[model samples]
Target: MIKTATRSTIFLFLLFGFLGFSQNKKNFSSIPNILQQIIPNDRIDSWVLVYNSYGKNQEIRTSGGKKDYTPQFSGFNLFPTEDSFYYIAYAAGGKMNYITDLEGLRKFVGKIDNAEEAAIVLTAEGYMVDEEFKDVAGNYYEDTANYYLDLGKLTSKECPYQKTHYALTVSKSSGDVSKVKDNGTYIELYNKKCANNPRLLKIQKKEEPKDDPKKSTRRK
Candidate 1:
């Protein structure tokens, strides 16, 4: 009788385990459908792994406070004949980054083996992970919620730092977390949090240069 009871318990545990796994799959089914459509093919085999990683990990994590992972992913179809969406992928092996620019170029952020967590490290140092972006094709994807701290943890005077349009087209040079007088790094401002953040509002108050540095000083 004891043997039978043990066998039944083992069976029930496995049954519930399988059900829980299936439920998790059901929750993330949409991610694959959306990502697969615009995934690039330059590194076909590696990108396959990234897709699998997305399926397994479909959520973001917060640590400490607002200083965790916040690398923005931005891109669109470079051309109608090709499909290329740029973003950072967190995988069991590590993170795979597809850095995209406004010129419609897509390339790996660094070497596959040595590139582990490069995006997170760079962003933490003030360098924007994304290159430049124009999401005309709606391929500009954002994996992070852009909220470093949860609502319950926020103080009364503090407000969540919301990314404008999910920071889709924002880009900055390596090691540039602060503002420069004439650095051409493109930035998307917060549409919602400026009212609550006086410092951010002051940054927004900077007038756009009439000369258009991107057109005059920068190259295409």
Candidate 2:
């Protein structure tokens, strides 16, 4: 009788353990396999994971405020013919950091193997392009030339709306972020029309001169 009771207790424990393990596995598998591999289990549980067809967005509330995690290629229209690039972003504390060149992402997520394959899986989810800026006068513009002009006008006391659109486009290409430039027309427009604005002047000062001063200014 004693032996039978011990055996019965052991059997029940094993059965319940198996069931619990199976349930956890099922829950984990529900997430995209690539994400399941990339995000650590604890972080996955604590963060609210939001998924769109394009990629995953994780939001976590810290003592400071909310932080968002999204794909590296966000805000750009990805062409199907382009090489697959993969990256992760952590945005919080008024700053955004991209993880691609280093092993930080893999280490943080606890996944080391099959990174390229995982990126392909995530990219397969979708392509995204952000919206362009539109002026109060109802004109839509892509580059920043008209954007800053309209921005200055809107911020003036004369305009009650005081609204302007600003956004950054970041893309990952061959394990590095791509360089984005304003259209030449936008640059010329900003210089001619909005140069007087303090903000515009600050931006212009940051631009490096195109020609080498020593070469161009030398007696010729």
Candidate 3:
């Protein structure tokens, strides 16, 4: 366990796509017009919002219009940790639509004590409502603008105050995560999009081995 317990922490809004995690903006009720401008396409089809705070999980699921979800996650304990919190989401074959402002979430999490990071887990398919974790043990994480976990590189955008770290991730198929890397910009691997189906992005390996050629003696 990564130990995501932070004090004086508050989870504003958490969005879950079949693939990515997002921050909820419902709290910006005072600035309705402004909020819309910030997140023009905040709402999407077959999307859900998972907001956690004060030891509870709140979700809002919808096909497109009406919202349906649980007010709180029962039996799950979400204690505030050192600038951190915990959350869960569903992955429909690793394909989903996510709407959020990564920079905003990072800023919000950074404000809380010990709240410099976050994580997301896409449980095994066919058991969306089941509380038990069915798939692998490790979970995806997003500290600010980066996403990582057991798997390699996921995303690397930009976090609050320019902080970066591993967070949550979900894989539709069973596999192992090796290493994570960033090209000094975007998270190339996780940001990939395909038509008609979803695909897992991976880091390209070097064609040549790391062994020093000069050290090798000529074959006699």
Candidate 4:
């Protein structure tokens, strides 16, 4: 009698385990339909995975902030004949990235000089880029043109320390480039906090003229 009871208990446990596994598949059944209706001219692959960041591992949240582990998928497609785009929904991680291709994604990651959490998504409207960089602990400094290139080549008329993080083709009704500069203003101003001897901004500019002393006097 004891042996029979033990066998029955084990059977029940295995039966419940199999049921649970089968239910997980049901949860994913909507993935194909969702992809077909939403993603145009694309093949999709869906996955559910735990994400790790900031030394913590947690489930993802949807745009509505509901915590759930549904299959998130990526689709690759060609649009407008020559243009290519891909889309991936990351229901967790609280972020989305878009890029032109996998190669572009890889290059973007390599270019990040400061360590920060990031993800790439592929899109048709050029690569939508977003990133975070470690800010100087405090203060701002004026940087040379070389310094600007080393960090990220950005043109600014009023500020020297601002950094560029995103680019988009701006068009007015007449199809002319808009003349407003936005982004990196605070990054430029905040740099003054950490700069040593703010006067060095002048010195750095001075070094360039030394290469041609005659040119230096011409400016004066």
Candidate 5:
């Protein structure tokens, strides 16, 4: 019999795989006023922010009256707006970088030449949260209440919030973004709203799993 812990690990692995592990579903929450302040004209319904704790640290002053400080590192934030575009911003290494669209994000990542590809790549690495949802039965569901990402061994023992990583996901198109689990559905929606771009088609093709001849023969 499989151990309980092993079984749990297996279950989560399967669940993540089924949901396209990189797509982190999240619940809707009010975008921070600070973030909203940055983009006043655009209407944003969803967003994601992740701190890259691996970078160089800086001293942060405590809020209390006492003069105390702590170390903190900058990270990145991704958000989609009413317009068919997403924004990526990063503050690290004593420098700040912000990009308003996929093309700019491509330059920031300096990896894939394609903008859509770069957007997907950066989104996978960041924390993701989804918006609120209501089923046909009129039951409302939300994910922002108690959801957290387990950093596992990467979690710091000294930190108060152990094994917790903040993340979120925002849909760029219409319909219930929270229900989108696999890459196919995501790409389908992307195409509908963004006009079936060639790069996204390439990503869809790549995500298709090739049939295994050996496995098929064994089944027969």
Candidate 6:
């Protein structure tokens, strides 16, 4: 799939409420208060940080938080950058938080590689784990930000519906994705809220056309 949006501002966090991924922050005995805290046993290679920038001026970018998320993500603590405006730091060794400052982040990722770029694009587009990719593990990416995934504008999603490759636009959330596409695999904990979803049921139930009985007959 092609990654859309060269520049994205995730202001409206909406859609599927999946569980945000978490990681434990490694505490060091020599914890420096400054940006020198980029220590992963004092060694790291690849890492990723997904974040959205916000400010008072909708036009001007400023050093602020990533979307509405706090420094605390699951178990990992999100480290802010000097310039938390136009950057998504490369993944170090473990799943680190999104840092805006490029120079400050380099101390961790070492160098921004191609893999890091792709990862950034994917996370920005709100797909894979960046958005709400389940099954890779118990980690559910329940991003509340309004996102655009391919052609399908998913307003919301309750669980993971294993697809067989059919392109469909799910505008709203669902309790039972099976009602939408009966012939697909799915993994879910609960959908008690989606049992009476009239919209999902309407998508599959097509009205049958009645045949005209008053048409011309052979030789009656």
Using TM-score as the measure, the top candidate is 2
Kindly report the root-mean-square deviation of model 1 from the true structure over all alpha carbons: 23.9
Number of clashes found in candidate 6: 14
The segments of candidate 1 whose C-alpha lies over 4 angstroms from its true place after superposition are 27-84, 87-98, 101-220
TM-score of each: 0.20, 0.24, 0.20, 0.23, 0.19, 0.21
TM-score of 5: 0.19
Candidate 1's TM-score: 0.20
RMSD of 4: 24.6
lDDT tens readout by residue for model 6, 115-171? 222222222223222123222211211222212122112223454322221111222
Per-model lDDT: 0.31, 0.34, 0.28, 0.32, 0.33, 0.28
Tell me model 3's lDDT, rounded to 2 decimals: 0.28
Clashes within 3 Å, all models in order: 0, 0, 21, 17, 10, 14
Report the C-alpha lDDT of model 3 over 73-134, residue by residue, as the tens digit.
Answer: 32221221233233322223334523233343333223222111222111111011111221
**CA deviation > 4 Å runs, candidate 5:** 1-28, 33-62, 65-76, 81-124, 132-220
Q: What lDDT does candidate 3 reach at residue 60? A: 29
Candidate 6 TM-score, C-alpha based: 0.21
lDDT of 4 by residue, 1-220 (tens): 9999999999999999767643432111121222222211122233222333333443322233343343323323321122323333433244443333445433333322211101121222222222233131111111121001101223343435444433222221222223323344334542444454367767677777445788878999
Clashes of 1: 0
Comparison by TM-score, 4 against 6, better one: 4
Q: Say which prediction, candidate 3 or candidate 4, comes out ahead on lDDT.
A: 4
Error of 3 at 219 (Å): 79
- Window of ten residues with lowest summed lDDT in model 2: 144-153
Model 2 TM-score (2 dp): 0.24
Report the Cα lDDT for residue 197, model 3.
19
lDDT (tens digit, per residue) of candidate 5 on 1-220: 4699899999999988757633543223332322232321123232232223235332221111222223224233344333222333344343444444434443444433222222233344442222221111011122332222211111222312122222223233321123222221111112333435567678789999999999999999
